[model samples]
Target chain A: MNKNFNFCIVDDDDIYQFAIKKTIESLNLTQKIIAFSDGEEALNFMIENLNNDEELPDVILLDINMPIMDGFQFMEEYIQIKPKLGKKITIYMVSSSVDQTDIDRANRISDVSDYIIKPIKPGKIKSIIEKLSMQEN
Target chain B: MKVNTNSEITAILATNNDGIVYQFNTDAETLLGYSSKEIIGLEKAPFFLIEEEFNNFRKDIANRYKENLDSDPYKLLAKYNGYDSREWTIIKKDGSRFVGHSTLTPLKNEHGENTGFLRIIKNITNQKETENELLRKNQVLNAAEKISMMGHWQLDTIADSVKWSSNLFNIFEVDTNQALRFETYFNFVHPEDKAIVSASFDKSIKDKVFYDLLHRIKSTSGKTKTVQLLGEVLTDNAGNVIEIIGTCQDVTQQRMAEIKFKGLLESAPDAMVIVNDSGKIQLVNKQAEKLFGYRSQELINKPVELLIPDKYKHTSHRENFFSMPKTRKMGEEGDDLYGLNKNGIEIPIQISLSPLKTEEGLLVSAAIRDITIQKIAEKKIIEAKNSLEILANKLTIQNTQLADFAQITSHNLRAPVSNLNSLLDFYNIAETEDEKVILFEKFEIVINHLTETLNTLIKALKTKNETVKNIETIMFDDVLIKTKEILSGQILKTGAKITTDFSQSPHIEYNKFYLESIFLNLLSNAIKYKSEERAPEIFIQSVIEEGVQKLMFKDNGLGINLKRHGHKIFGLNKVFHRHPDAKGVGLFMTKTQIESLGGNITVESEVNIGSSFNINFNK
Candidate 1:
């Protein structure tokens, strides 16, 4: 695993976290798959782990539903921190909801590369990786 | 009343067939003032009766002598004078004329009068005058009897005999031939009044008191009559009470009038407080008692002020109630007047006081009606209006605040977002994955978060009451088609199948925008909550009932445990799914949109089998 490639997975579900972790491990695409259970915990973790040159996640697989801080709330906090990280973090809004609002919101964000409905398979993760590579080129 | 026979008596028997003098009766001679001496040979007789003086007599003779010979003596002499005959009078010795019946009959031999010409101009001046005087007296008596509604009857106490005048017999409906005995007359008294009649007789005869009383009488044919018997003690100085003389009058009409008048007073709706000049209540009906909440006994003899509230206690209207002229209505002036209840509570009442006048003086009567319930209903209406005004002001304030929020969230961020997108597109390429991932992820994450925040703000904005629009019929198929069209890519990607059944034609009565938003949210959630193990299957259907339309969306996805998250399922940002894409905005917006359209959404879910969302809308 490349230490330069650190990634984050924010979701409330253990099963979804396992699936996203397995997909990332099979591809061995990043150094550390930092996992957080909710938007608030993941937001605190991101604030503590900031570094100037450390590469932001090549991709982030974010689950929409959480207890106190859902995906929408996490984005509110995460979007403000993105300018300081100064690193490209490709986000794929992953959810079991094919809801238009989730799909629409993911499409609306300039930072978000695309939207994907879970459970995230290896192929979907590869597709997200391809989108990041395209941005890099 | 035959006084004496005359020396010459000649009878005139005349009819339309023949004018014959059979033998003029002696009374005819006396009536016409003629003897057999001068008129026996003369043609027109020495007596002449003036025509003007005997007009009715001439007509009587004509009527009786037309075809049949009348036995009436007056008619017999009357035929001797014809229509052209003048001066129906008799001549005395000196030729002085006196009104009388004159007869000229053809003298007959033994066959049937008409011997030669027995011209008998009998003067009946004195006799006719006496008959006229008797008739005049009888006419006056009849007139008096009719006017007084009275008739006379005589009873002989000795023979137990009763003799009634014509008017008296008429009252009993009997002929003169029917002997009236003491018992027969007593039998005429009504059975109900027999005792009274008997007592009256005892007082009149044995006790020597004047018998005057009102009682009922039963006639011979069993007809009951109300009558007044006024009699006096007609006795010699011996005081034998020889015969009872009395006048009886039918008084049934008067009695019935009294009964009906009493009934009217008792049944009248408006209270009749017959107060004397002393301000005392004399009569109070049941309605009056109920209106004032006092028993008639309690109200009577009490001053009318008991009913008047404290405000009018010292008023002149109360003091001079008895002195006022008889005015049928009270409160000619419009004023808010009231009455006091038995419980001493003052009830608002429309009071009308009236003066009932009699020969005795003026009386006051009051009509009171309670208006408490009407006053209360009016007060409630005023309160409701005040509440509605407050609600309107609060709604206006909330509406302006919402407009500001929408501008800051959706529009304000749009420009910055657009700039970020453009800057990213213009950037040069990086060779290394580490360098590119670092920068790209930062901008991407920021934009994504901004977009999600904006969408939540929009959800909150839609729930405000000020955004409610005019109601419209929501077509089931149209809304479903539009929402599905918007999420078509998501549907294809999830491998989900969506079908609609509107067999019942559930076109909801709702706002069009709200219905569209509800449809979009429910269908999207069905696809979003799909179980990983299987392809999603969703059915959207509707049902119609009496006045309501129900929409149902069922999905073969991971269902929720209603027992755990039931209360918060429709709440804002209340998401339960573990899926990474579940933003939790869809269900919250769906609930609000449904409610704003005057409808409700309910979910039935089990963790894995399936979930069903039902929406009930007014039609």
Candidate 2:
């Protein structure tokens, strides 16, 4: 696992956040992990540090049901600054909702690679990374 | 044997069989609508007149063979369905319908026994119409008299005597009530006019001159009516007038609405024309000339129908106006109809039809207003509405596109993640018993997560992408029967009581397949999620509101907490309670199917109480 490849998670539920964090560690997916309680904080933090060469996360798990600046709104703003950051970044949508509307919205964004329902685990995380590698080649 | 002529005896001196000149009569010819020549000289009666074809007026023949002629033939004519009866009908020479009277009687020889028959006939058509009119006049008198031709009166002298005309009674609707008398005359003259009438009469009587005046009278019923009285005193050679004779007419309604009608013509925000019944322009204001390109003086004598389109000219005949009887029914005016313009261009107009009685009779004065600008304004409104509809459609399309994107992303991404997680967790399970339990938990968690993602997709589609399908009149019992058949054994096991009543009639406009799904899903859920207290009781009935038909299915099963999960009840796999089979998918699918068929579902429920779903379908 590369420590430089930081993972960022934005989810409102503490239980979901804890589970994703535990799965990341158990799979040896990455060494560094950062979490935000809501979409607004995550988006703000990412924009403020967008200029920093190593500040951007390699992967993001964006939750749909955040209180302010929902995942869709964050994606709209975040996509504008993607080239400026000069980094390989992928966003995977995460939510407890099984609503197709949210899934379809996530699929429409090029930067969003996939969607995952709550309680993400090691095996699911590995498959996402593998798919990303395949696409990059 | 000629009953009235010695010459006929000379002719029997001419022919045989008693030369029955006895039958000769003037009316007998007229009664059959035929000539006396056909009846008198003919040996055989026309079979058309006799009900018994070959019998040849046989009963009359038998009586004639016995001979007695003095009996009145008219009553017998009616009895034998003869040509001279009081109630007579004729068969025309062309075999068409006719009206006539017929009679029959016996002719006797010197022995005083019956020998031959004599028949007398009369045609009564001329009197029929007069009596029929008498009948109609009795039925509704307002229709009997032409209400448009009104009249007025004036008493030229002071009064021990007075005068009246036909129309004064018409205005009072008195022609129908009682016999007209000099007192009936006083009953119609306005009370205020009474004093004026007396004063004017005294003045006129002293001078022996005529009186012309307008006055109001309180009719016998105390209703005030306006009347114009115009007449002179009729006198003997002494110049002392014997009595006052005059025309009294009601002008109440016209006197009130005339000023408004004139004002409406000039300042009427629109044009107007008043045309007499003969189709000549009686009056036209400035606005009308401006609209039609002709001065009122120029158009005055021209036919009013000239302003109407050629297509409508055929419809503007006086006969059309005369078709409906002239009745006293007021306020339900004739259509504010159409007319042509001077330029021969048809312009939309709102007309008011009123009757004016000149010496000529009723004239229809049309108060017309042009609606061209109003039509233009309506077109503008329609254009705006069309643009707004386009905008709404655009937004709906965008919304649908976004929903599709969400559904695809959620469904596509979850599979790989769940499989990888389960595979890794499975390896850990074999290492130790504690690890095995942990691995099983991990596997369950990943699978549940995957299931929820799939469910979200289904739920979103249910709410958004459901499209309408075939619509038909779906019978309630048939749908229920199909549902019961599908879940027949399950229902038997659960022992759920499902009572149905169509007594109020639940058949409505709906798709058969969708309606079937609606009942199936609901009943299945009721049995699947039964409240454990006792056997479930489900009530199903049809309801209607404002022409919309609804089917209500209420179950006494474990109900949902509407306050918490109300909005998401039909969401995919969003299970309300922890039942093993609580996938929450049934409601989502059911809702989709129902909505696709242009129907709706609404739920009202309380936690652990009961739930009732009312489904309304398009009619």
Top-DockQ structure, candidate number: 2
Compute DockQ for each candidate against the true complex.
Answer: 0.04, 0.05
Which lDDT tens digits does candidate 2 get at residues B1-619? Answer: 2222321211110111333333445443333344556545655433235344223344453374343443433334324433422334555445654344444444556875455555444444555666788777644543333364355444434455433344556567564546544556654566656777777756877777767777777765677777766676778787777666666556778876865766766776645666666677777888878877888788887877667777666644555664442422221233334456665667766655556666666666555667667667868998999998988876775575465445445433443363445456455546678866655566666567666766756665654565655678878988888899999898898898999887677676666766787888898888887888868888899877787878888898888877656756775444666566765567877876665555668999976778898887753
Model 2, residue B272: displacement in angstroms? 11
What lDDT score is found at residue A56 in candidate 1? 48
What is residue B396's positional error in candidate 1, in angstroms?
16
Model 2 spans > 4 angstroms off: A1-137, B1-287, B290-371, B379-474, B506-510
Q: What fraction of native interface contacts is shared by candidate 1?
A: 0.05
- Models, CA RMSD each: 23.9, 32.8
Off by over 4 Å in 1: A1-65, A68-137, B1-447, B462-474, B486-499
Can you write out model 1's per-residue Cα lDDT over B491-526, one digit (the tens) per residue?
Answer: 889989988888888566677877788788888888
Model 2 chain B: ten consecutive residues of lowest lDDT: B7-16
